[model samples]
Each structure stands twice: as structure tokens, then as C-alpha cells.
Target: MDVEILSRIQFAFTIAFHYIYPPLSIGLGVGLVIMEGMFLKTKEPVYEKMTRFFVKIFALIFGIGVATGIVMEFEFGTNWAVYSRYVGDVFGSALAAEGIFAFALESGFLGILLFGWNKVSPKVHFLSTIMVTLGSMFSAIWIVVANSWQQTPAGYKIVGEGMEARAEITDFWAMVFNPSSVERIMHVWIGAFLAGAFLIMSIAAWYLYKNKYQDFSKKAFGIGLVIALIAAYAQLVTGHSSAEVVEQYQPAKLAAMEGHWDSSGAADMYLFGYIDKKKEETVGLKIPGGLSFLTHQDFNAPVTGLKAFKPEDRPGSLNITFQSYHIMIAIGMLLISLTSYAAWLWRRNKLFEKKWLMLVFVWAVFLPQIANQAGWFAAETGRQPWVVYNLLRTSDALSQSVQKEQVMFSLILFSLVYLVLFMLFIYLLNKKITHGPWHTDSDKHSSRHSDMATELSKPSSQS
Candidate 1:
């Protein structure tokens, strides 16, 4: 492969490594807020123990996320210098805002959340939990805003010409409210919530199956189940909205997603496929007019195809885009099924007896992580050939100073480094989990009774 290919591989590898933690951090942040809030409201020692146990995991993931993400910023300048200049104004504002508002806020309170359990009041610690969760969400918002602008650029005007051209924001608010930003941000948040919820469920399921921490497992399972269902359903809604936006603004990318080839008439959604790009045919089972119905609420509405665009402008690698998107959708559907089945069983109050379901949850923790990566791949590569959508080709965006060999060397080096980091993360996470929470059943009961007594001793006022 050439320098461009090497650069793409390097960036992809680093980003894939970096991505492993942010969603977990965001998801675990939500979990911390919920568990801590419950502890404060009910004064239950179980909730308090759960919050403390998860905060450690959150801190670990957040630390790793920060370390990995910093390299991407340097890559923008070193590997994609032209792109850096082209969109510097836009990305700078978004990323700077993220650092100032999101990262700073999260890091500031994270200290208190992780270390202030005994140092500060429970109310203060609970407030830290809320702030951390919001900060994680806000981190997601600005990042999505920047990326969404690339997918569907808005409120910006190109200045200069040719090699000197750059996009400058004409309307700051319009730039922030880019066409795809809100939908993408919501989808990411929902996915993060699902990831976090499944992680908790997996651990709880493991505990139940092993006959360890029975009370802890049940409480965690209940909360995780509710959150997973809410997020899973919300994912369906947000995913649909995102597709509609894609149909309107990036029809070629939409075409690649479904392997839709006709320039007019209805689009059929493929359930699965082997797309032969030269023949422009997809060999798969497809719902007739399914895409049209989904996008336009009409079975026969016209949907644009790749043929509508000039060959040069068409997104490269329809197969990669098609497969990645369909796989993401398949995983999403599976998540809904898995969560719904468990929810139905719980409604019958027979969930605990189902050892099979618990076993499934123990392995299903990887589902959302897989889906999130696949979705990310589809979103980025689907808009192929272009770094800034219609504005700049990825080939033109590469650093003139960098060579193929340099990128290749770094790629190999970083891959090995990441492998070590991944192993260490798993080992540490497993160790903490094996140790279990700090509280026993007796300690929990004593705390609960003490809380009740304190509540009873408080003076009642007649209003």
C-alpha cells in the first residue's frame, strides 16, 4: 500500500484502540450517577457499595480514553496536515470547547467521585456523579458536532481557492446545529448507555451464575435491565432518524448502506448481501421497497443511487460500507431481542431461575461494543474518498512531508504498544471484579437499619 493507505490504516488502528474506552466511560458515568443517586435517596448500603465499585472502573476507562485520544490530535497535524488546515477553525472551536467544558468538568469532579467517598458528604459525592455523567455527555456532544459538520457541512463558506481554500464559519450557531449533529449525538449517547448497562448486566449475570454476591447481582441486574431497555429502544428511534438525514444529504452513502443501485424508484433494504460493485448487484435477501418506506414513509418513493453522482464523486468500496452498516443494524436488532426477552421473563418473575439467560448476558457484554465500532466504521468510511465530504478528497488531505515508510513503522510500533495496554486493562479490570465490593450482607443490613432509625428520629412538622 501507499502512504495514503498506510496513513488511513494507522489512524484507523489508533482510533479503534482509543474508541474502546470512551463509550464505556460515558456509559459507566451514567451508571455511577444512577447508583449514587439511589444511595442518597434511599440510603441503601448496597447502592453505595455498587457506586464505589463502579467508580474505579470508570476512572480506569476515563484515564485510558484520555491517553489514547491525545494521539489523534497530533495525527491530524502530522498525518493529515492539509485536512488540519482546511478544517482547523471548525475543529479547533469544537475541540477547545470540549477541553474547556467537558473534559475539564469531568476531570475536576472525577477526583471527588473516585476519592471523596469518605472525605465529602454523600450529597456532595452524588453531585460529583451527576457532573461527571453530564461531562461525559457533553464530551460526546462537541465531538459529534465536529464530525457531523464533516458529514454534512453547514454555515461555512470556503475562502481562497484551490490549495489555499479553507472553510470559515459564517454562522456559529448554524455550525453547531449542523444537519446531522443532534441525531448522531443522540445515537452515540444511547449506544454508550446500552454499552454501560450491558457491562453491568454481564458482571451481575456472572455473579449470579457463580453464586457470588446474590443480593448485589439482583439489584444491579434490575437497574441494568431497565436502563438497557430504555436505551435500546431509543437507539432504534435515533438510528432511523439518522438514516433519514443520510438519505436527504448523502444519498450515495445511503445507497451504499443498502446496496441500492437504481437512480430512481424505490430502494429495497437488504437483510444481508455480497455486493458485486462492477455489476452493481447485491446478492442477498431484501425487503422490496423497504428502504423507501423507511426513509420517506412511502413504499415507492424515489431514492437516489450512486449512479446519480459522477463516478469520481461516488463513495469508494460499496461493499465495506454496505456490510459495516448492515452488521451494525443486525447487532442493534439483536440487542433489542436479547434485552426484551430478559425483560419479559422478569415480568413473569421467572428471570432469576433462567440460568441460560444469565449465561447469555455474561457473554453479551461485547454486543454494544461491537455495534458501536461497526457504526463508527460505517459513518466514516461510508462517506469515502472525501475527508470533508464534498470539499476535500482524502488523498489530497495527507501530509506532504510524511512518507509511507514512516507511517508503516509507526503503525507497527503502536499496534504492539496497544496490545500491551489492552492486556493490562483486562487484567486490572478482572482483578477488581474478582475482589468484589467492600460490603458484606451484615454491613449492608446494619447501614439500612441505621438509616431508618435516623429517619425515624428526625422531628415531624405539621403543615
Candidate 2:
């Protein structure tokens, strides 16, 4: 493989791995806020116990997210120096805002959130939880704004030429609110919510399945189900809004997403299919004119296709883009179905009665993660060859001094390090989950242990 391919893979791998935690962190932050709020409103000891338990897990996720994220910043300078220089001013402003507005607020309140349980008043700690959650969400805003700007460049002027060429912000707020930013931000936020909610539900369902912590499990599962059901439906709206933005600004990507090949016509939306790139055909089950209606609210409205763009300008991996997009949609629909049914059962007071449903929920923790990854794969891959949309070709963005061998070696090292991190994370997470939420009731103890409250509530257990 050439330098470009290797560099792309390395960055992708690192970022993809790093991507796992932020959504969980963000989602969990929201959950924390709600849990803590409930404790305040109802003065329920159970909610406090739940909040405390997940606060520990949230800290673990935040630590890992921060650690993994630093690598990508360094990679920008090491592997994509030209790209960094090109977007530095814009990204700088966004990141600086992130540091000031998001990170500062989040970290400032984090210490209080983690250790202030005994030291501070309940109201003060609850305020900190809200602040921390807001901080996580604010962090996402700047990051998504920066990324969305790449997809739809706005309010920037090109300064210098050739190797010295870079984009400078002419209007900062304009750049921040660029065409695609809001929709993309909402999309990402909702996805994170689902990730966090599903995770909670997954664990809660597991506890219920094992006939442990029945009260806590039911309450936690109910909270997760509410968030999941709401977010799942909201995703549909944001997804459509995002598609509309893509159609207007990045028709080529929209075409690639749906495997549309005709130069101009109302496009069909595929439910599932195989794209035969060689033959320029997508053999699939589809709704005829479905995409056209979605994008234009007109069944016969013409949508641009891949043929409208130069072949070299088109996304290189049509199948990957198409498949990843479809996978995201498929998982989303599945989640909506599951959550809706779960909500119905809860409403009927039969949610926990179904052992089969509990079994499914125990494993459903992975669905949001998979969907999040697939959504990212589609967005990034569909915009391929352009790291900064029309402004900078990905090929031209590499650090010319770096060799493929160096990239490959670094990639290998990163993989090994991340593998160990993942293993350690899983081990610690499993240990925490096994410990279960601290409980006063002796009957709720697992077969493997007694006095879970005494064991899990120790100061040392905050890790």
C-alpha cells in the first residue's frame, strides 16, 4: 500500500477506536443528569445508588476517551501535516472554544461530580452533574461543527497558494453554523444518547435476567427505555435532515449512499442490496422513488446521481459506503422497533415479565455502538478523496516526509496498545457490573458474592 492508503487506515483505525467512548460518555452524561435529578425530586436512595454506581463507570469512559483522543491531534501533525495546516485556523478556533467552553466546564465540575458525593450538599452535587453533562454535550458541538465544516465549507477564504495554501475564517460564527453543522450535531448527539441508554438498558436487563437487583434493574431499564425510544425516533428526523443537506451540498455522496447511477432521475431507496459496481447496478429490494420523495417531497423529483460527477471524483468504495449506510439504517429501524415494543410492555407493566425480551436487551448494548460506527463509516467514506470537501484532496494532505513503513509500524503499535486498553476496559467494566449497584437488601446479592453494597461502596471502588 502507498503512503496515502496506509496513513488513511492508521488514522481511521485510531479514530474509530477513539470514537467508541465519546458517545458513551455523552450519552451516559445525560443519563447521569436524569438519574441525579430523579434522586433530588424523589429523594429515592435507589436513584442515588444508581447515580453513584454509573458515575464511576462514566469516569472510566471519560478517562479513556480523553487518552485516546489525544492521539488523533498528534496524528494531524504527524500523518496529515498539510491537511492540518490547511484547516488549522478554522479547527484552532473550534478547538479553542472546545477547551474554553466545553472542556473547562466539564472538567471543572467533574471533580465535584466524582468525589463531592460526601463533601458537598446534594443540590450542589446535582448541579455539578448537570454541568458535567452539559459540558460533554458542548464538547460535541465544537467537534461536530469542525467536522461538519469540512463537509460543507463556509465563511472561509483561501489564503496563500500551492503548498502554503490554507483556509482562514472570515466569519467565525458563520463557519460554526455552516450548512451541515446543526443537523450533523443533532444526529451525533442523538446517536450518543442511544449508545448511553442502550448500555444502561443492557446492563439492567442482564441483572433482571439473573434475578438480581430486581428493583434497581427495573427502574434503570425503564429510564433507558424512555431515552432509547425517544432518541431512536429523533434519529429518523435527523437522518432525513442530514440527507437533505447532503443532497444539496454533496449530491455525489448522496448518490453513492443509495447506489444511484443514472445521471439524473428520481432515485429509488434500497432496503437491502448488493451493488455490482462493475455493472453499475444495485440489485436490491427498494422503494421506487422513495429517495426522491424523502429529499424533495415529490415522488418524481429528479436527484443527481454518481454519473453526474467525474468518475475520479466519485467515492472510491461504492460498496463500502452503500453497505455501511444501509447497515446504519437497518440497525436504527431495529432499535426503534425494539424500543417501541419495550415501551409498550413497560406501559402494560409487563416489560420485565418477558424473559425473552430481557435476554435480547442484555445483548442489545452493542446495537447503538454498531450503528454509530456504521453512520461514521458512511459519512467519512462517502466523502472520500476529499478530507476537506472540495478544498483539499486527501491525497494532497499527507505529510510528504512520512513513509508507508513508518505509518504501518505506527499502526501496528497503536493496534497493540488499543487492544490492551480494550481488554483492560472490558475486565474493569465486567468487574464493576459484577459488583452490581450497591444495595442494602441482602436477598439481592449474587450467587458469587454477599453484601454487594459493602463491597462496591468502598472508596477504592470509585475507579
lDDT of each: 0.87, 0.90
lDDT per residue for candidate 2 within 1-463, as digits (tens), equals 9999999899889999999999999999999889888877765557877888889899999999999999999999999999999999999999999999999999999999988876677788889999999999999999999999999999999999998999999999999999999999999999999999999999999999999999888999888888999999999999999999999999989999998888577789999898787888899999999988998899888889887888889999898899999999999999999999999888999989999999999899999999999999999999987999988999999998999999999999999999999998999889889988873232354311223334545655566
Question: In every candidate, how many clashes are there?
Answer: 0, 0
Expressed as tens digits, the lDDT of each residue in 115-218 for candidate 1 is 77656777787888899999999999999999999999999999988877889989887999999999999999999999999999998999899889888788
TM-score of each: 0.95, 0.94
In Å, residue 292's CA in model 1 sits off its true spot by 1.1
| Model 1 spans > 4 angstroms off | 439-463
Worst 10 residues of 1 by lDDT: 440-449
Deviation in Å, model 1, residue 241 alpha carbon:
0.5
Deviation from native of the Cα of residue 413 in model 1, angstroms: 0.9
